[model samples]
Structures are given as structure tokens and as C-alpha cells.
Target: MSKSSIYLPAGFRFAGVTCGIKASGKPDVSLIVSDRPLVAAGVYTTNQIVAAPVVLCRSRTPSSTVRAVVTNSGNANACTGSQGDADAKAMCAHVASLVGCDETDVLVMSTGVIGKLLPMEKVKSGIEHAVAELADREEAFFAAAEAIRTTDKDRKTESRELELGGESIRIAAMAKGAGMIAPNMATMLSVICTDASIEPKEANAMLRRVARVSYNRVSVDGHTSTNDTLLLLASGTGTPLQGDSLCLFEQELTELAIQLAKQLVEDGEGATHVMQIRVTGATNDASAETIAKTVAASPLVKTAITGGDPNWGRMVSAAGYAGEPIEPAKVSLRVCEELIYENGTPLKFDAASLSATMKEHPQVNLDLCVGGGNGEAVYWSSDLTTDYVRFNSEYTT
Candidate 1:
């Protein structure tokens, strides 16, 4: 797709601007506004110590329509007690006032360092500037993507278009996350907009289903953030999808979400390679997911991948502790097409060739088959490196 092809659905405008929040002086605030009330659905982090913004947005769930979303980076506005909640509400109210909508029609999201109060004055100025600059254009969309970044290496955005109900429908999304990205229901802040009309109930169901397999399946550092939020807004500017058209829309949403999820892993903090873990022949999908996630979150497995060491033992150990019943005698393992373990024994393989393959490929595939029950799942993750350690060690300083 061309650079200009990533357009937002009709009736939506975007803006991103710098507040004095980040020491780097980069854009730290973003705004997304619809020309009219748009149906909105969202999934948020399951973390117990939720951010103020997450709490606020969750309260607005099942809302028939929302007019705007205001987001900020460089300050998570989490764990600040009542003050954080006040700040979050202030953000929504500010955006609502600018957009001529009720505060309840505005959703708020925050990312970056946690346990700090928001710089309200700077945020106020930034929101004013962003609202003034809002426009329905690629540049504005790119700015919105850039403004949500914390440790991310670059802006992540995806777009899809298809003919549905004799109308050209478009879906576009932008996400920002590179660390603290494991999510129970969502990932680090993402906003998706589509022109196809869909009711709030259907949108909610579709968002949850798509998120389960996409954002919820990936892990960066195995630490879910307090501000993980994913919102889908429908402008209702095109024909409403029904029957097969709705199915097609769901498939396209899944594809776009998966694309964005992989982008987050590829840009994982200090990550050198992306590892895809697949578990098949399990008792059920839940079991498969547990095993895949276990292997994906294992530091030993991640570090081994970082060093190009095809250590199969770590993979087996991870699966064993995943709390799923496994027939050790029937288990099989492979890394990028090389079957190194099967029939209860580790097969002899050329370590040099495997290491060379790891060195040459930025993506490493690990598949584990435990007996034959037809259940399967896939999870994406990044290799843990010393650079990851170093970057995080000095992240707050």
C-alpha cells in the first residue's frame, strides 16, 4: 500500500502533538474525533492495579456511541491514588469540551511511566493544540501513531479495504507498544476505526473475539501494562455489514489486528528476533494456548533464541510446567522445520547448521506437538537480549 493509503474511515479526524511530558520533547498526546457519534467498543488490561484511564474507559463499556478518544504517553497516570482518576477525567472533559460532546462520550488512555501524576498544565496545552490541528488525513494519522509511543522504535499502523454491501468499507488502526506488553484482553494502546456501520453489541463481540487471538496471544516481557487499551470505532458512513459481509469484516479485523500485534513484537524493546510458538495436538484450544504462552514467556527460551542457541530442553521444560496433561512419550518438537525431538528422545541434529539458520533468519518458528487431539494455537514473542536488560535498567532515568 502507498504511504497515503492508510486513511481513517470517513467522519473521523486525528491529531498528535507534543506536551512537555517527555524529556525527549516528542509528541506525547493524541486525539481521535468522529464528526458524529460513532459506535465504540473496547478491551482493556486485566491488571489488578489498573491505570486511571483504564478504569474510566471500562465504566463506559457498552456505550452505544462515543465521539472522541484522548490519549497520552510519557505518563501512565497509574497508581497515583485519587489524583490519577481526577487527571483522567480531566483529560476526557477537556477533549469533550473541545469536540462539543459530553465527557461520557470521550474515552481516555495513558501510557509511559507509572505511579506519577500527570502534568495537567502541559496536557491542557497539548490537547488544545491537537484539537486545533485535527484533520482527516494521513499526516494526522501518522502523528497520532507517533504520539502514543514510549519505547517503541517506530509508529505501527495497518489498513484494510474491501467491498461490502455494495460499498467500499475501510478499516485503519494504529498501535504503540514495545515493552510491558503481555495482555489478558488487550495490548498497549491501539485505536481502530472503520467506516462500515455495526451495532455496539456486535462490535463489542467482534472486538473481544479478534483481540483474544491477536493481542492476548503475544508477549514482550511477560509484564502486562496498567494502560493496555484497544478501542474500535465505527463511523457508520457506509452500509452496515450483515451475514457474510459481517463475517468478512470480522476476518479483515482479525488480519489487521494480527499484523499490528506482530509489528509490536518486531519492535519489542531491544529485540533482535521474533519467535513464533505453535502448539498442536493438545486436548483443547485452552491447553494449547497455555503451553504456547508458557514457552513464549520463558526467559531461558527467549535468551537462548537471542544467542542463536537451539536449546530444545528449555522448550520442553516450559511445556511441562504449563499445567497441561502431556504424554511425554508422544511429544514432538521442531525449530524452523528441523525436528529435533520426537518419540521421547532428542534426535541428533547439526547444531552448526541450526545456529546458522537462526543467525540468518529474523523469525524463528518453534512447533510442539503433544499427542494427537487436533487442538492448536500460535503465539508470537521476541527474544530476550542483554540490550533489553540494559534499555530497561536505564529506562526511568
Candidate 2:
């Protein structure tokens, strides 16, 4: 989508600027500020070893009076002990002072290189410059999106508008991620802002519900990161939504989040194909998700996708070992809509044609049916390529 067409929600200003934090001299600091206090909610990394910003932000979220977010890239500020914690708080303190709000009213997020200390001098300067340049324009939002990226080849963003109570409500979101993805979410960081009026409780509930099905359903290399965070802020500039309107807002929010998540997967480091896996007929949703995740995380399955090979056995074997109860006689598998196996037996089909089809499509769909049960799940993953391995091998060098 063109940057000019991107929508900017009411009551928010954004800025992204370079601060000499990245070796490449790219924009490394990003700020999101609201003209008025707004309700805020967050979902953080499930990884026990979280970054300092994650810890600081997690404690103060689901709040009704948050005012801004301060972020920096190229320094994750993780595994740096108490000093990292102090730096995170200091970032909030500085932004709070500039934004004219209490320190706790600001949130913080950081990504890139773990176990490195932030260059405080550069960070403080960056935050000050970012705040000074903040603006509520599409260009500002685009800059913020670009600044937060690390390994991402392209910025991920989406916006949606809906009418609620005869007033327009806008939702805009930006995300950054290209690797370290898993079911519990990964190194990804996302900020979603809406002009609709919402209570803190509802905002928190909706963020978690949407995240479970969106950010938490994608995997790149099955390695969760220490700085995954998804924050939602409601400026309440639009009329309060109720009943059907509220449901519609949540639906739109979910769709927007899913779009950003898929963008992250599509931009995975040197990725060529996105694997869209669907697992049905499991004992429960949890079981279905486990099976799907197992297949997504399997190197053998991913490699087959990278090579455009219709290796149905690799997928079937991965599912069987997923620790879920499944009867082989009741299981069926399909790749790119072509049935390859059914009811415990391999089906006779044109392997060459199916392989060609897989190579021709950017999204390879894998459908697995274990039994005629009600449980089902969908997951997204990127095929593992030689380029992915090469890029990550020299990531820090």
C-alpha cells in the first residue's frame, strides 16, 4: 500500500529518527504520543527472559491514562541486569517529562541485539529529537514503522476505519519483525491505536483475544524472542461503541492484526514461501494448535517447502509426533489443495504436477484432518531457505 493512503487516527502523533544507535545509521528511535491521556493495554513476551522495556511496560499497562510510547531499535537492552531496567525507566521518565505526563504514563519497547547496553547518550538525544519532530501525519506513521524494523526488509502496517454510533472510528497499527517468531509470539513489536472510546478492561480483553489468534499463530524458526510486545491504545476521540458496533470494532482489529502478522511472515529473513497450515478434527483447539505448530516448526517440513518438494510423509510424521492423540486411519493430508494421503494410505496422484504447483504459489497450504471432531486451528510459517541460514549466521558480525 502507498504511504500516502495510510490513515492516521485522531489524537496521536508519531516520529522516527536516527540516533547513531545502529551501525547502518538507520532510524533507530520511534515515539507514539497522544494529545490526551488514553486507555492502554498490552500483551508481552511469554519468554521468562524478557527485556527491560518489556518488564517496565508490562507493570504499567491495562491503564486508563497512558500518554505515550518511547522505543529504540538496534539495542534490545535485554540480559543487561539492573542497569537495563534503570535505562528503561529513564526512557519513560524522559518521554513523560516531554509529553507532560507522569513517568508511569509512558510505555517503552526495544529490539535488536540481546545482552547489549544501550548508548544512553544517543538514546536520550534520539528521544528528544523524536518528540520535537512528532506529527499526526501519514509520513510520520510511516517513519515510525520503518524505524522499528531490524531484519525486516519492508515495513509492516495497516489501518481500518468503521462507523460507530454515526461517527467514524479509525484503527491504525504498525509492526516490525522478520525472524525469531513462534507460537508465543516472537521478537515482534506492534502498536495499535484507535480513535474509538473504550474502557481499559475492554481494551485489555480485546488485545489479548486478538493476539491469541493473530501474533501467537505465526512462526518463522520457532524461536521466541525476549522483546515481543503488542500494545493497544484507545484515544476515545470517537463515540462509544456498543453491542454490534463493539463486536465490529473487535473484528476489524483482528483482521488488521492478522494482516500485520502475515506481513511479518512474508518478510521473514530470505523467506521465499509462506506455509499456511490448517489442522482440523483434533480433540480440542489446544491439540489442534500443537499439531499445526509441530508441523510448522519441523525443519524437514520447512525444507521441503523451500525446495518445492511434495514430501507429504515429512508433514504426516511431524503431526504424528506432535503428542496429540490421532488415529492414522482417520487422518488425511493435502498440499496446495491436492490430496496426497487419505485414511492411513498414500493416494495416487501426479507428484510432478503437485510439485510444480507448490513452486508456482507463494503461499503453500497444508490441510490435515485427524478425525471428525469439532476442533481446528490455523498457523502461518515461512519456509526455511539457505539464505535464511546465511543471513542469521552473520547477523551480529
lDDT of each: 0.91, 0.92
What TM-score goes with each of the models?
0.98, 0.98
Q: Using lDDT as the measure, which candidate wins?
A: 2
Q: How far is 320's C-alpha from truth in model 1 (Å)?
A: 1.2
lDDT of 1 at 385: 90
Each candidate structure's count of clashing pairs: 0, 0
lDDT of 2 by residue, 1-397 (tens): 5645676789999999999999999999999999898999999999989999999988998998999998899999999999999999999999988889999999999999999999999999999999999999998998998899898898889999887778888899999999898868655999999888998888898899999989999999988999999999999855457789889999999999998899989998989999999999999998999999999999999999998999989999999999999878989999999989998899999988999999999999999998877789999999999999999999988
lDDT tens digits, residue span 284-389, model 1: 9999999999999999999989988999999988999999988888889999889999966999999989998987899999999977877899999999998999
Q: Which stretches of model 2 miss by more than 4 angstroms?
A: 1-4, 237-239
Q: What is the C-alpha RMSD of each candidate to the true structure, in Å?
A: 1.2, 1.1
Model 1 misplaced regions, further than 4 Å? 2-4, 237-239
- State the weakest 10-residue window (summed lDDT) of model 1: 2-11
In candidate 1, how many Å is residue 229 off? 0.4
Relative to the true structure, candidate 1 has a C-alpha RMSD (angstroms) of 1.2
